[model samples]
Target chain A: MTENNYIYAPSEHPADKFRCKVPMKGTRQLFVIDGGVQGTAAPLSIKFDEGNCSDEILQVIGVRTSSGPKELSSESSFSFGQNSQGRLILCSHTFAEDPFITKEKIKISLAPNSSVDIVLMQNEHNDAEHISEFEIDIQRDASLRMVFLTLHGGKISNNIKVNLNGENASCDLNGLYIVDGKQQVRNLVSMNHKDPHCYSSQLFKGILDDASVASFSGLIHVWPDAQKTQAYQENHNLLLTKEAKVYSEPQLEIYADDVKCSHGATNGRLDENELFYLRSRGIPKKEAQLLQQQAFAYAVLDKISSEELKERMVSLTEQRLRGEFSKCKNCCKNCC
Target chain B: MLNIKDLHASIGEKEILKGINLQVKPGEIHAIMGPNGSGKSTLSSVLAGRDTYTVTSGEIEFEGKNILELSPEERSIAGIFLGFQYPIEIPGVTNVNFMRTAVNEHRKAKGLEPLNAAAFLKIMREKMEVVEMNPSFSSRGVNVGFSGGEKKRNEIFQMAMLEPKLAILDETDSGLDVDALRIVATGVNKLKRPDNATIVITHYQRLLDYIVPDIVHILYNGQIIKTAGKELALEVEKRGYDWLING
Candidate 1:
């Protein structure tokens, strides 16, 4: 519940328009920060460089509204204590309403043998617009696992960059998005392997319907010194309607021949055999589709460790897939 | 229980089953034996309503109703089952869950009450013994990590659970060992009743030795050329399909 623990540091991203003259402070491990404004909100930046503890954990949860045209910006950098752990759980929800925008950046520094996990969710109003930029750093013997989910939004775009600066550094980035209508989502990612023996894997998937559009551009770069590095990247998109569109590109550049790296991208319709199999098993066509889709999303969702959060996301995901969430604001009107 | 007349089927303009006719009354076990590429699997697929094949011209009747217009699930609800030659391996859905869902759907279609958890588990246990399936396999994903024999047994286990009025085993013996074949054949034999019918499609008579089909038909080039008693199977075993296709 603490909302004033972070400060506005010198950031390379476009600075927020409103810079507070007085500094605000609170506890480090637990805090709340809100950003993104459309109808009415003062531009602000977030920074957290204090709270030097060995086991600092940050859990992020999000909520949203669209009363008027407003914009929100958030920026923060984290450096974990040695042999400690950190977690970021991002959840943002918005009902159907007017438009809002967001500019966000996050950085994490893991000490040797330390690990971090980040779970992010962005579900916005259909009329809302959002854009985000992120930068992350992982140090020696440190690992990072990130799960980013975008369920609903209008004209959403994300730019992300990660730097593995130490040996034995590992990173896993997984994402899932379900979009429909005129909505559009785009993601661009850059992963850097700076030292030897680093490992990175990125898996992203999306389901688009009703003329919606999605794009993914991700690259994994292995430097010369990053020999013995192993990197894998993949992007898969399912177009539920003929009018829906998707563009995916997964790239890998290895300067060191000793490293193993691979990339793949596929955009197509659902598997006909799988659908028929379920249908023949006595499930109606629509129910069979939902089952298959949930299974498809499971490839990425299973990576999450929190049961409560996973359950919530799964419920929301089913509603979105059923075309029941975006239309209802207060309660599920489709059931009625 | 099932009747097919002038059944002509094709895949992408290539005809497979051309002007074939067959009939199977309740309580009878009919075996259709044929060599490779003789439309054996296609017949099963067509019966199962697989979209890969087009029934250019045919009439399929099941239980006094026209089944050609029925969707796959509708046909399943009407009590028609096809034990696939190569069973599909679904990685996430479990065997128990799959069977429960199927059984409930059939019940729902027939205006019967859905079985409660306890009742369903009891029936599952009883049916598992028919196929000699280990109880531990109920939780594993459908056909995932199962050996060839285990998969065949699972198919039969599913059949036992559903208790379809008409069951067609499509080459269910292709990749099975002697013991596995015996178990599967025994399961099928024990499930037979005067109210239900079975169609065993195989390339070899080895299976017929166990199930002992009441009627054996030699299918060649998309049509049933000969129909006889169980002795027909023994004759085909001595002389391969070449005699049937050539004569």
Candidate 2:
């Protein structure tokens, strides 16, 4: 099967290539399937047809090691049967000194009475460009929880579409992006409720600094027959500099008379009164600012159900805010 | 051990606290009573080095060091504290973490080792009891969703934790119920020491009845027009500020 072609031995690759140091407990690490394939496209598929699947987490790491400016494409599909429960983590990293471009298309499906949690972490060097598109579907009595964390990248775009095709389905989507140094990030999300008694929520937050730019556009659609549908969406952004910019738009469309929907978007700066209060308590200006930024990010990080993973992500986020990961520590050439 | 001489301050074009002189010594409590818009809050803000008010011409010396050039945090590290009229609410920052960070900063300035988690928690628990605060408040956000009395008690709790040499309470009696006022005053009195001083600024004499200041000053029209003993507070309470302002 094509799945076997994408599975490799973890021992063949070194662990230092990945920027995050958090160890995923009880997780099966999937190595880079197309390690040496330069400027080529790879297609992979994984299926879970068995019922009552185990709680083991599947972790996939996509790494690009070639030192030339090349383009790569990847397409993946994941499906789960009825009554199955699972978790998936997708991470992308680039160790090359030159600029690398990547395009990814992923699709996920959940059958009746199934549940799943997915986490996508994008942490690449400054010379990397990434674009990811996700299409997800849920059947009757199914549920999904997803989080996207963008720590560092030059130009990143994420487009997500979710459809509730059966009754009693629910989904929670969340994202956090911290960008600086001429970086750009864009996120577009569309949630569709087609049946009765379905629910959805979306919350995304971003912090931009040093001439960076970010944009968020989210849409929630409820069909005519989708009675008792409950949906909510919100986007908040904090700009740290005059040059930093953000554009946010939240839209909602409801054809059903018995549905509830709400959307809100805001752009603001750090509270000056709060900063003065903290400073009056003897905390330095820089340290107080870092604390505020960390507090701003905790809302999204608190959604992770795994305690160990949450702690690790918290530390990683703190390091990123402190500008520790902005420099290329592993690359032989000091490009950054 | 605090001194202010010829202090003149302003916000934008309007001037406040014009040419004021005051002296406070160790082991003493001084009360500054003034009407609204008489610069009571502005004086407190200036003492704590808030950037909103510009010190046009003044000199503030604490323990023989000029403090007007210092930042808020620098002044705080130098043992100066100002209890705000309205405590700010900071979401997502637990009281325990905030106190720990502030206490550690103060300790670091003194070349002392930081307290361990257990030691810090023990100290926090002991100080929290001074305000009769419940243990749950330690893990909640700083002043988030707290009642007016609870916010005042939290200010006192912070004062007890920092142990500053010079404490300035700006209108600590406003919006406080009788019970909360007693608790907060008691907490402040408990933290008093022979080597420190306090400046309690209030509009009414109800708080003075509990704290019992040693000296009282009447501030009017951006100046301290009269200075007297504790009996002056009773006089002002009996008669309105009109008698003192006119004479």
Candidate 3:
């Protein structure tokens, strides 16, 4: 039972490079290694029993190492009891400069009448390869809000599958990814409506620059018995250069007749009229472009329920848009 | 304060303004009335440095300097403002943020310090009142979800904030109701100074009733066919442009 106001991993551990600005008060921070909790017996580790439930936020930081011959992998699971409320923050970062590969699997389950908010941030160096899968099960009268923020990475693939198994369950999922310089990021999301009177909605946006590429494939499936179900999904992308590319596919498969389902996808450049309008008001061209990009990214960032985290994410997103994260290796500034 | 001589401009291959000439002095308001497709908006766009229109020949001189090479932002920072007919809606950038950036840029161009947030808010609140805009509008996105009249009033509010030397209002009264028109007109008139000028481009003579112009120019087919005093607008309103074009 290690409880500290602020927990910092050992300076030698790779998790020390996790750059997220940690929030204050009632946070349990832990560092997991090599896909298992038994690798390092640190002060931050906490043993969780079946009945262990608290209202505090659980912050988990995972770091994968490619120094060994075996491929790195991580597996973690979390379940909440009925009528409980909690928050979870998962941040994964790889500091390896060489070719590295890692796979992570996360499972979350919410009991009846329970609610949870989850934020997953994936930031890795340009030479690293990572794949993450999230399986979420939401039950009767429970709700879930999840945000996936992919700030910097190379060859990152995120697979998220959500199942609303009980009546009156709802899920709101959002994602934002900004990639540049030959990086490639992909998001594959599938939402299942298995019960009646369930609702789900998703919004994902990305901004690609240089020769970066991004892909989004989202599906909404409704069962025949899932009457009175409502689902919506949208994915929008902004390509800054001719070389930048995006592939968006939003699909809906519905077996129920009395359900509402919609999906939309758009890939576009910055609006020239909007740009001209900004510049005509004396804002410089560069600033005007940044302003538009920031505005585009803010739509997803605004979904965060916590004002403290929202403000921090907004500032970080601004820095990322301003090209401040381009040369992260040699930069000595602690921007976070 | 502004002079345009033989301003032959075109969009792609289609010539819009053919050998147009106009002179505006300080402390004066000039009204240019014409029918649709007569290149009234084209003249305004050309003056505000919109890149869609190319100046095939001629020069635009502002305060003794040729401004044909200036970018839209440079023109704006150099004290040229164009009140758009349809104000653009920027969904996430608030009016305060947009106007603060613009005002700071203008101040920077003049070698002055940028206004702090407190000082900027004070000025914004004051200017917003000139258009009778609610204080809440300052926190909203620039013209996002605003009505037609609200958009027009926002343009006038922005003009008041920038305090340009040459303010060009292009069809600003088209969508505005009578009350909104009076508010916008009063805002423009209140900002008038001895060193500033305005060019009101409209198709209706009704706007001239509120902000009376010292010179009125009737444009037809990319050329000014007639130039007269304030009485010209009343005559055009009564007899229509056919009588003037024929006589």
Candidate 4:
């Protein structure tokens, strides 16, 4: 809506544009470009330092792709790129965004033997929308691991789509979301297997309280020629308040006979038997409940690769459990 | 000392104990013998303040103070102990923590200082030796996966730690083997003092052979049909419960 002024060039290819200069703001050292490339084929390399952007640390968000590969800032609102080999690794970092504002799409095109790692973070205090559209072209013997973690935000939604283009390629999608105090969150993910011998695995975990609502819907499609493909999906939710609700759907649509696929969803409250057992031993009810909730949220938080980020997330999760989000109604997601 | 006068109790709409009267003084032991449904266990439950039973009409006094109105935990702090007929299995709550909390709670209610962790552990070790129970067992959850004999032994161990003024053993010998019964009885005997009392409830007279009672009372149809010295227990065991019920 701001005049579509993102830089788009026709001189470079997706495989040969690693050093293209992009402008940046704030106190971070990394600068990300938002425009697309139209004609040339080249690989892109991302470098972060103190000259272009400020000397402070930087995290990126919003990724897209055009005719050539694109490099994005760690905290941008939108970005897009593509490669031939379809190999990607999105490294993890912190970012800031608004919850009420609508943002652009982040697209990626992977060429043969090409890999991408996009690590975007959201630690802002305003109302903003973060929407990323990923188009993956997985070639033979190539793989992808897209790890996403929503540590903080007022309202958050992630839409991911991956296509298996070649035989014997695989993609693993893992996500963790913690919401509390009237916060609403939605996660929509879809994977399409167009060729044979491709595998896809999806796992999503969440905790909701203070009248919050969370929904996760995952879909997997296997074409007729996608024989022998193994696909598995799971979604688990924990509701701390009586008014909190979680709606999860794990779907699988296969058109081949030699494929094995399974999907499961679980939604429930804390264990009452375990609570009574602790209380009978003189442990106050509240402390026992906190310990149980912390143990329940451990598996999801452990997926984070950064030790500092993971520790922060665990502390935030505890705060969320104790209704900390209501205190920082206007601050960023990291407040909880 | 513990005293009960015209104590009547019921479970739901069904009356289980009818006008039960008894008294136990310090330095003494009393056994209540009855057939099935004769209210032997019901009396212990009522004395322990278990919510499942309603006392229709009764007056219970412990150490010259009324005790029927107190809660289960309050009664426990008042020096009343009930060794459950069927001990409950509480998972994830270790026996050591349970006993430590109980002891400190009782002590605090009595205007006494609480024991630190080290002192508490030392006291627990000394008490555990009374029942010949393994020191390592206290680290596991309360009565979780314990054998029948072990459950009975743990009950006595708890009694030893709390040092209740009036300890009630509710059918403590029902499931114990001979060796376990002797050990459990010895633990109860060792805990007794000139200023404390014990009430033993059992359906069979065999337990009385190990834990000698100063008096024996037969409960039939919710009422104590007869009262006598320790000789009554041997007489009833020789004949049967019918001798007392019929007369």
Q: Is candidate 1 or candidate 2 better by DockQ?
A: 2
Candidate 2 fraction of reference contacts recovered: 0.64
Per-prediction share of native contacts kept: 0.45, 0.64, 0.73, 0.00
Summing lDDT over every window of 10 consecutive residues in candidate 2 chain B, give the lowest-scoring window.
Answer: B89-98
For each candidate, give its TM-score against the true structure.
0.88, 0.92, 0.92, 0.55
Instruction: For candidate 4, state the interface root-mean-square deviation in angstroms to 1 decimal.
Output: 5.7
Write candidate 1's Cα lDDT for A118-197 as tens digits.
77778777877777777778888988898888888887887889899899989999999888999999989899999999
Off by over 4 Å in 4: A1-336
* Top candidate when judged by DockQ against the true structure: 3
* Cα lDDT of model 3 by residue, A26-117, tens digit: 66555555454423433222322334456677777665555432466666677766777778777776644667777877788888888888
Instruction: Give the number of the best model, judged by lDDT.
Output: 2
Candidate 2 interface RMSD (Å): 0.7
Reference-based lDDT, residue B149, model 4: 96
Which sequence of candidate numbers ranks them by DockQ, best first? 3, 2, 1, 4
Q: Give the DockQ (C-alpha) for candidate 3.
A: 0.83
lDDT of 2 by residue, A188-260 (tens): 9999999999999999999999999999999899999999999999899989999999999888888898988
TM, chain A, every candidate? 0.81, 0.89, 0.87, 0.66
Candidate 3: where is the Cα deviation over 4 Å? A1-28, A33-56, A64-70, A326-336
True contacts kept of 3: 0.73
Instruction: DockQ each candidate and list the results.
Output: 0.48, 0.75, 0.83, 0.07
Q: In terms of docking quality, how is candidate 2 classified?
A: medium
Each model: TM-score of chain B? 0.98, 0.99, 0.98, 0.98
